[model samples]
Target: MDNNILILSEGMQTSIQDLGRKGYRAYGVPIAGAMDKYSAILANKLLNNDEKLPVMEMTYTGPKILFEDATLLVITGADMSPKINDKPIKMNVLYEVKTSDVLSFGKLKSGARTYLGVKGGFLTEKKLDSYSFYEGITSQSRVNKGDRLRIENYEAGMELYSSKIKVKRSHFEAKKLEVTKGPEFHRLTKKHREYLFSKQFKIGSLNDRMGCQLKNKFPPIKDQEIITSSTIPGTVQLTPSGKLIIMMRDCPTTGGYPRILQLTDMAINQLAQKKENDMFKFDLESSFDFLGRLVFRFKD
Candidate 1:
């Protein structure tokens, strides 16, 4: 008997994602994956599954799923107020579902995306050596209503499990984003450079998996156009029109805009949890400077 989950109602945006695809960017393929990799990893770890297991990434809302077999699973990242058979469940803890059990959600309490991971992970098709779903690179990009997600079956008579490890409350807060100097950081005029650090940027409605569009407040950089060059997730680019775009997991491999800054991995994780109109300040620091602070903080 095969174990599967039937999607009754796909919420705002639901897609399967993992860590990301690597070593294929030179071929024009973006490393599409979970926007909040930290939470995704947490969900998998709670269930004792592989760290790279593909999990469902639900944004703003969550999907309604009906299980076809007994299974162990966990929800992390956003708190969408998930429920099983009309019983409210908490996040960061494992839960067991019986056959024909219905899982649904209520209002989104925090964060931008929620991650759901079944024990042993979902069985999805892989492309270019990854299970991450990218529009043009995967068999399908988003989960739709009525989609069936195959899952690994648990052993018969296996004991159900739960956890008490609550994901840190700080995961949902977006205040200061740590950044390092980019290749073009030094090219900016003194005033513009100072403005970048002093200004607070609001996440615009144009934000998507490809990149985060931030509403700019200061003057535009002069002669910001640049030659096309390699780009990666966390790269902050400034366009000619004074718009600021921070590349995300699904961003293209290269861009022509002036790369102004690069976010630290922790900052990228924090930024991914932000929603439209969310405000955040930029905290500029170099890698070496950050290392010095870390060493000082932990000195014997």
Candidate 2:
């Protein structure tokens, strides 16, 4: 019999994701992948699987799955309260599941996203060299109930029983996001710069994988329009109306708004676990001064 996981209930937003599709952004493809890359990678690492292996990215809630074969698995990110046969399981640890064992999740104790990694990864379609499920780029955007996901049937070795990993609690609790000056940072006036760093910004209602809109508006720049330029995950754009949008994994390839700040890779992962109404402050460090100079030279 082929190994498979039968989906009993599709939770809020469960989908297959890896590290995201790269090199296709120039062609206008949004890199849709696991929002919390650190947790996703950690889950894979704990399972002794490739870090880039496709795993289930569960948002807010989690899906109920029935295992068809014995396999090693691990859960990380967000305390979604995972369980097997109604018995609780710990996060960041590897365990074996037997045939007919059902895994489910309860109340979200903390964080906003969760990751489930299985040995050998999932046998899913790989488009553009990625298993990331994007709206138009992939056959289906999210997993639905009644879906049977293929997996590898395997018996765990002794190495699986001795694996142990510790996750940092700060990743989900930190409120200070580290960012570097972006291409248009030089355009901001002294007052605007002060406002950017001084105030706390709330995650707006329009938050998702595409981007995060901040509720607090910064003072709008006199010249709000800018020539359309390349954008990537973590590019913080300030709009004419003064609203700030932090582009995420599924943002467009280019944007016209002024890119005033860019979050560090770690900051992007940090922001990914934040939900609407979450408060955070910018921590503009000087470590990226050299990169800021390079951006200013070309953008100016």
Candidate 3:
């Protein structure tokens, strides 16, 4: 009846993340869900848990786990060579872990982040009706070494399930991330704006929950002054240092940087699929691309 997952060892940082709160970014509340949101959904869906359930968000690596009792679990996003008791378990599939059978994760093999989910949700302090926002939240971290995740027993004795879902290689090979022209699209120089939508830019390394910086050719922004108004996750702000910062899951609500272009929801999801140094180009448009972006949709 009682099945709680205990953390035995951690990698760099891992924390409990749900789907994150909505309608709060206006108040500077970032939607702090799993970095790879689709991966989390896959984990949750594999275990029949609600999409909003708190799952372990593991970045780069994951923690060793000890189950208080038998439990069901799944993992998705990024290849971290996750194994159970020295035996590798296929990712994107449901699996069983007996009590004392440790679950461990190794260094990142393909992607940057991964999600580990159990049949029941992770027991963590829920603020604003969610257990996300680890950076601002002082007490918890995205799964680290020596952490514990309390869960409940969903399946009784002799429950064994195993299957692997191999995400198509093309999904990982995507190179283009489309975006809508920013609200201040008209503010940019005619030439600079034109060059932006057509030219391809490399996704930089200065990226995290906060945002992502795209490399620029000595950017078009020469000044540093601007009126701070509203912003969202898709906002692309240009800093004085000539870096284009694309806001992500945990971005600030307002900033003085010159807003360049805003990624559409589809593009944002596509952005999550991007690897370091991935070169991408976005087309400029007068309106948002509302439909026909199925590939960019984050799916389980």
Scored by lDDT, model 2 comes in at 0.90
Q: What are the TM-scores, per candidate, against the unseen true structure? A: 0.94, 0.94, 0.86
Better of 1 and 3 by lDDT: 1
Instruction: Give me the runs in candidate 1 sitting further than 4 Å from their true place.
Output: 156-159, 289-300
Q: lDDT for every model?
A: 0.88, 0.90, 0.73
Per-residue lDDT of model 1, residues 32-90, tens digit only: 88899999898888888888999999999898999988888889998999999989998
User: Mind sharing the TM-score for model 3?
Assistant: 0.86
Candidate 2: tens digits of C-alpha lDDT, residues 103-210: 999999888999999999998889999999999998999999999999966875644675777778889988899998999999999998898888899999998888
Return whichever of 2 and 3 wins on lDDT.
2
TM-score of candidate 1 on Cα atoms, chains taken together: 0.94
Residue range 1-300, candidate 3, lDDT tens digits: 445667777675567778876777766777777666777887887777788898887666677888777778888877799998989877798877777888888766776778888877776777777888456653655555555556865665444455567776544555566677676666677777767877888888887777888876634655557889678777988777777889887777788887778876546655766766888887654433444354356545
